[model samples]
Target: MSAFGKDGVTGLYETHLPVARLERAIDFYENRLGLERAYTNDERRVAFFWVGGKQSGMLGLWETGTAPLGMRLHFAFHASEEWLLDGCSRLRDAGISPLGFHGEAVEEPVVIGWVPAMMLYFKDPDGHSLEALHVLPQPPDRAFGIRSLTAWRQYAS
Candidate 1:
């Protein structure tokens, strides 16, 4: 018998990001990332964007003070490889830097060796770290170890 039980928890419902300004954040998510502006409230200083769907894939941006220096929050969206690549190209074409794990300009997608997920990362106008990842469809190996992006490249060398 499996140890796992039905916890009524299956997948992500929604996520929120704090920003210093609402309108700029809304523009970034909408114009920059092409997310649909589902809702907005200037009084509440909040904007909600539909990432993929109206119900589940919702991302909210709320106006708040900036985080303390060196403090950052990170989140990721599950994307197909094609979608991620297209997004990278789009952002880069708009003169935005496509970032990887180190938050630097990405020459290529960073491959997470453990989960074997291919991912790309970037920052919002508020400096919020965001990522797009594609988890490879493959079973895990029993003998496993984690490797950094640079280190993982050694295997292919």
Candidate 2:
């Protein structure tokens, strides 16, 4: 059904985002999220952080004064199911509101049946959408659609 072969690519290694302030972004990512600082270019007003592990994956933040209207981007970070399940309280404690797919505040993660993954959403200081996700062990079920994790278990059972 697909034209591409299996050897096309492995996985995502890096992503870049525009930020209003480099220091603030660095603080949120480094001090808050605990990502290791890989490098920072003061001249270019850019910073890089190592995600997961050193030299494995990276996130880059570029200082752009202000994020343009409707320029919000989204990215997800791989997380454990346990971490994602407790995301709501953890995020709330960190002053971040956990959100559902529609951007409404929620107490738990949702299961996207297409991907069959449990995911929680939030926004960064720059208004860029962020997610913490963990793939389920079951096979994908497009017909199942998206729903709360509780509903997903009911349907699956």
Please, what is the TM-score per model? Answer: 0.79, 0.90
Instruction: Return the TM-score for candidate 2, rounded to 2 decimals.
Output: 0.90
| Model 1, backbone clash pairs (residues 3+ apart or across chains), number | 0
Local distance difference test, each candidate: 0.74, 0.89
Displacement of residue 62 (Cα, Å) in model 1 is 0.6
For candidate 1, write residues 85-149 as lDDT tens digits.
57668778755678877777776677766677778888888888988888765454323344344
- What would the per-residue lDDT of candidate 2 be over residues 1-157, giving only the tens digit for each residue? 5565686756689999988888999998887777899999999999999989865789999988553553679999989999998999988888889999989888889999998999999988989999999999988999988889998999998
Give model 2's clash tally: 0
